[model samples]
Target chain A: MNIVIIDYGAGNTKSVQFACHRLGFSPVLSNDKDVIRLADKVIFPGVGQASNAMQMLKKSGLDSVIPTLTQPVLGICLGMQLLCNTTEEGHTQGLGVFDVAVKRFSNTLKVPQMGWNTIFSLESNLFLGLKNDAYMYLVHSYYAEICEHTISQTNYGLNYSSALKRDNFYGVQFHPEKSSTEGAQILNNFLTL
Target chain B: MLTKRIIPCLDIKDGRTVKGVNFINLIDAGDPVVLAKEYAEKGADELVFLDISATLEGRKTTLEMVLKVAEQVNIPFTVGGGISSIKDVDSLLKSGADKVSINSSAIKRPELINELSAKFGSQCVVVAIDAKQIDGQWMVHLAGGSIPTELNLFNWAKEVEMRGAGEILFTSMDHDGTKDGFANEALSRLSTELHIPIIASGGAGTIQHFVDTFQIGKSDAALAASVFHFGEIKIHELKENLRKNNINVRL
Candidate 1:
């Protein structure tokens, strides 16, 4: 499969590519529009501030290309957050693929809810063969609220959308690549989707 | 629920794992990548690689080790030790490290915290504070707890959080290497006062100590070196013990 991980200067793309490599696939890392469009599966990964990432995306015109992709595109972490309508981080507008607005976790809990958390209420093939309340590694301050596109739910201080799906575009708040075996399974499921 | 984390810290020197690791079924015990993969399979929530290399060549080898570990290990890992600038962090993260922990550099120039957090998002910047109690005052220390600073622990931690540190890895030098227990009093205070997650390091001899750090210290994660390195406490068994203690662990 011609797998391309969109690299718009956002961090963690190497880890994502290595994850795909460990799964026996050598995924390409590219920011070019045509290279991404020609991929059988596309992985969009980001791990920095939202507004800065959005700016980078807009600079490369990927903000427009990403929303128009017909292949199964999996957005991980900040990549996932950028797919939403908007995010509270930096008051940035997103690519508007999921139709859900991302909100920051209240200060009552840790700002960036780090470490392993259980993700449940799985409703998509992305989590196929995964158990309920499966632990996925998450590190983010902003989360998309539960919506019609939400495929799974996770509780930090409250129930929020951990995974969202809207046709070809799927987003996960957790890093399936860094989430160990079960996470690898989810990545495989997405690749095979 | 967000479960508590059990982190096995690997100290690297000249591209080799320092302090003997006693894990069985290993051709090379000093190989950080192999040990990292073993720990991940054994149920370690996360891993921390502290580069204790003294020379420039050693540091370069440490970076290569980071790349190797990142490629082989599936779980999240942090690379720390002598990381001072955005350039250093950028290379490490680009090499596939999930996070970079800064110590003395952050203390020397507190703005480094703000700068790192601003550039790399708070989630990727971990401010590791090594402090010890001196004359009933918790004072921050530099150079692996050999040099002392007048800055108070709680005050420094508060500043770190305000400066946008995603997490604080607090190591009580007094409790570190003792295996007595974590500094739960100071740790609980840090957790209560700071909104960011606190990772309790040092003083981890027993599984119960792990339990105490999470329940009493209110630590989001616990990091230890000797017990895990010497294979005195197995990650899988330790987690089971934590689970039995009603503590939320990954298991």
Candidate 2:
């Protein structure tokens, strides 16, 4: 099965691609809609503000094709925010893959948590092999709040949704591509699905 | 809760790492790739590579070295030295560098901080400030400690932070390679003043120095050299010591 990583002029695309290459899954890196549509699993990764990211995605016509994907689609970092109904980073609409809305974190804690942090899996399947409190890499200021689809949660300043699953669509605020062994295992689980 | 970090810095000149006692008698440590891979595998939270000899050559070769080290390590890495523009950062990030550190360029044109942050986000740009305590007042130094900028450390650091620097890598030129300890006074002031994470560099001589720096400096991360290069202390062992000191760190 071809695993396609959608590049919307975001960050850490090559590392994600390289990690997939090491996992025996040579992912196809492209912004082309046709290539993404043909893949068995699609991994959308972005590491920038939601508003400007949506602008770039719309310019590339990804905003139209993203919600229509029938395969198991995963979003990482800002990719997860773009999958939400709305984001506070910019004045733009998301693909509405999930019912939640993304908002900026409170000024209490640091804006961007840049190291490894623990995430407790709230649901099954997506975190089958993963431990209950495995640490993963995170680097973001905006978070997706819990809705009807939150499958995982992590507390920072207060409790916030770290992982969400709705139908075949999944979203994670952490970077599985940059996280250590636990992150690789998460990617492996995403692959078997 | 987010755990603080400990980083080991490797100063490379002409594609080889060098060790100095009082910033002299530079000895060939080892291959950059080999050492970087060792540090990452040994549980180093992050790594910083400074091209110490940027004046001798251009940036093409240094970025090539960055690509080589990045291919072998899976951790976050920051590259600095002679990076003058946005295209330079793009090339390094394209080569898999997680962060692009700027020193002389940031001092030359403060707008570079805004430009890079606006384009790639502040989290990707690290402003490295090398300051020397002169007449009891910390003064900022530029051009790899070769020249002094008239800007004061406190004012300059706050200005850079306001301009959208994701993090600040502050080095005390007076303490660098001295192995006495960190500039606690400067670090404390910066830590309490800015909301962004600060990585303390220089004067890391012993394992307790790291613990003291973290506990007293109140920095989010502490970066060291010499000790790690001469095998004075292993990265994991230092982290264990930091943990024993009641500091919140990833073990």
Candidate 3:
């Protein structure tokens, strides 16, 4: 499979690539429009501030190219947040893929809800073999509020959309690549999609 | 609910895994990649690699070790111990380290925390403070708990949070390597004072210690070395026990 991981200077792409490598797939890391456009599967991974990442995406002209792709695209972490309508982080605008808004976690809880949390209310094939309340590694300060596109919910202080799906695009707030076996299964499901 | 984390810290020297009792008398454990894979499979929530290598060549090998571990291990790991600049963090994160923990560097120049959190995002910046109680006061120490500083543990932790640190890994030098328990009093205080997650390090010998650190210490995570490295406490069994105690864990 010609899997391409969209890399626009976002961190954690190496770990994502390594995850794919462990799953017996040699995924390519590319930011070129044509390379990403022709991939059998596209994995968009991000870690860092949202506005800065959106800026990088715009600079590479990928901000526009990403929304138009017809293949199965999986956006992980900040990549998922950038697929929403807008985010509270830096008041950054997103690609409008998921039709949701990202809001910062209230100060009552830790700003960045780090460590392992359970993802449940699974509503998509992305969670095919996964059980309800399966643990996934999450590290994010901003989360997409539950919306019509939300396919999974995780509770930190409240129920938030941990995974979303709209047509061909899928977004997960957790890092499946670093989420051990169940997470690898999610990535494999995305690949086989 | 977000579960309390069980982190098995591996002290690295010259590309090998080593464990020190009270930060001294290092003993070789095994190949880092092999040990990391074992810990991850055994249900370790996360891992911290503290590179104690003093020579330049050893540091270079540490980078290579990070790369290999990232390639093989399917869990998140943090690379720390002598990271002092953005350039160093950049290389380590690029090499696939999930986060970089800054110690003496952040103490010497507090701006380094702000700079790292701004550039890499606070989620990837972890400030590890090593402090021991001195005459009824928890005093911050530098250079792996050898050099003393006037900064109080609570005051420094608050500043770390204000500077935009995503988490604080507080190690009680007094309790470390004693196999008694964590400094729950100090840990709970830091957890209550700071809004970010606090990782309780140093004192961890039994499963109850892990439970106490989570329940009493109010720590989001607990990190230990000898107990786990020497096979005294098993990650899976410990997590199971924590779950039985009504404490949420990844197990």
**Which model scores highest in TM-score?**
1
Off-target runs (Cα >4 Å) in candidate 2 are B20-29, B53-58
- Winning model by DockQ: 1
Q: Which stretches of candidate 1 lie over 4 Å from their true place?
A: none
Q: Which stretches of candidate 3 lie over 4 Å from their true place?
A: B20-29
Q: Judged by DockQ cut-offs, is candidate 3 incorrect, acceptable, medium or high?
A: high
How much lDDT does each candidate structure score? Answer: 0.93, 0.83, 0.93
Please state the Cα-based DockQ of model 2 relative to the true two-chain complex.
Answer: 0.57
Candidate 3 structure quality by residue, lDDT tens digits, A1-193: 8999998997589999999999999999999999999999999999999999999999999999999999999999999999999999999999999999999999899878999999999999999999999999999999999999999999999999999999999999999999999999999999988
Error of 3 at B73 (Å): 0.4
TM-score of chain B of each: 0.98, 0.92, 0.95
Give all TM-scores, in the order shown.
0.99, 0.94, 0.97
Interface RMSD of each: 0.6, 1.4, 0.6
lDDT of 1 by residue, B1-251 (tens): 99999999999999999887877789998999999999999999999999999998999998899899888888999999999889999889988899999999999999999999899899989999999988999999999999999899999999999998999999999999899999999999999998999999989989889889888999999999889878899889998999998999897
Q: Which ten residues in a row have the lowest lDDT in candidate 2 chain B?
A: B20-29
CA RMSD for every model?
0.9, 3.0, 2.5
> Which residue pairs collide in model 1, if any?
none
